[model samples]
Target: MSALLAASRASLRASKAPVMALRRSVHIENTVDNVLPFKAGKHNKGKVAVGVTAFFVTGLSLPLVAGLWQLYVPIAHARSK
Candidate 1:
């Protein structure tokens, strides 16, 4: 019978080994060590420039604020009188 032949073919096919998929792993590298301490102290200059700018800003603004407060006191006293 055709059913019996199909059963025998299915049984024969099951005796072969199962297939497995294989893959190669991807490689990665760290880049931080190579980039630090940049050329000719230019990177350090950027940091120093920021610090200098902050120092100048703070130094100049304090006197300006004190002068403003000094000017405000006279006007406030006049208004109160």
Candidate 2:
């Protein structure tokens, strides 16, 4: 999951540069429509941010629940020795 997020960040960064460059070259008259694609890029950023947070929180919580169970359950004990 971490690798996936890293790859996504890298991809976004790599693609953003050229789009920004394109923005600078376009005529000012239709600028709003010309830059419309970039607005979708911003939405992609939001989606990626949410995805990373969801994956991270779920990843951290699963092992924690197991660890707590091991600590509190008597019959599940291996640490008693």
Candidate 3:
């Protein structure tokens, strides 16, 4: 009966040590709900819109330019003959 009590105490201590270590190792932060609140900005919004428009326009125009060049090359070759 004494050995069983001692074993139970040892197991309890072993389980509690890990719980204490985990509690100490955890880091709690003061988090806020509005970390970055959205605000209207005409200048910045215009710049971002222009940048996105330019990006998509350049992306789409490159393929169109390439296709046009391909068509022009065949037409020019046929005209040269």
Candidate 4:
């Protein structure tokens, strides 16, 4: 029983060093910066902003309009009846 406990403790201590080294090496400061798909240049800044805004507006409006149409259809049918 004592030999088994000593072997387990030795294995645990051996495993701990690699885990500590990994924790020290894996830091946010050492990490690479996230790459962007396109570079933001001065000439295309406005274009990028407009494109993003248009994308969000269209993306959001489509679902809203669809839901409003769905609500309106039921109301219209009830009124016609």
Candidate 5:
């Protein structure tokens, strides 16, 4: 009887718990600092821009490449057959 009651309580808690969700992080401020000679202003603009662009492209490309690989595998297999 105790085992059955425990199982019921576990089910109730599982049902009540919230589902986990992924969240996108937001950057509100300049995270870079002391490491660089120039922390802010016009001098760092081009460098910062290129770094951000490279980071953004790498971030975007990874998922796209994975999805394309997933799509490509079936075509490759069928061609092999």
Candidate 6:
């Protein structure tokens, strides 16, 4: 058991050097030009708006729901004597 433990420990220590050597800093530019690069921004913008609207409507998270629910949900009668 000690021999197996020693071998595993030695293997783990040996593996660390290559992993450290492979580690390096990475830089990614975050810009609309770099990310989207759309030839027609106006059409693409409208498409994105439609997609986002569909997503929210499908998820039932539209902002007007809370206010509309008050108008739509049936009001309960008073139970107090």
Using lDDT, give the best candidate's number.
5
How many clashes show up per model? 0, 0, 0, 0, 0, 0
Task: Give the per-residue Cα lDDT of candidate 1 at 16.
Answer: 58
Candidates' lDDT values, in order?
A: 0.73, 0.73, 0.75, 0.78, 0.80, 0.68
Q: Give residue 16's error in model 4 in angstroms.
A: 22
Off by over 4 Å in 2: 1-40, 75-81
The ten-residue window of minimal lDDT in model 2 covers 32-41
**Alpha-carbon runs more than 4 Å astray in model 1:** 1-40
TM-score of each: 0.41, 0.38, 0.46, 0.50, 0.49, 0.37
- Native-to-model Cα distance after best TM-score fit, residue 75 in candidate 1, in Å: 1.0
Tens-place lDDT per residue, model 3, 37-61, is 3322554677668777999999999
* lDDT tens digits by residue: candidate 2, 1-81: 999999999999888786556665645444633444344354476876787799999999999999988778976565675
lDDT by residue (1-81, candidate 5, tens digit) is 999999999999888876553344643555554444455556777888888899999999999999999999999999999
TM-score of 4: 0.50
What digit string (tens of lDDT, one per residue) describes model 1 on residues 1-81? 999999989988775545532344744443643343333254476776787799999999999999999999999999999
Winner by TM-score between candidate 5 and candidate 4: 4
Off by over 4 Å in 5: 1-38
RMSD (Å) per prediction = 18.0, 16.5, 12.2, 6.9, 10.2, 7.6
Alpha carbon deviation, residue 54, candidate 4 (Å): 0.4
Candidate 1's displacement at residue 25, Å, is: 58
lDDT tens string, model 4, 2-80? 9999999999988877655666563343223323355456667788899899999999999999999999999999999
lDDT of 6 at 34: 48
List clashing residue pairs in candidate 6.
none
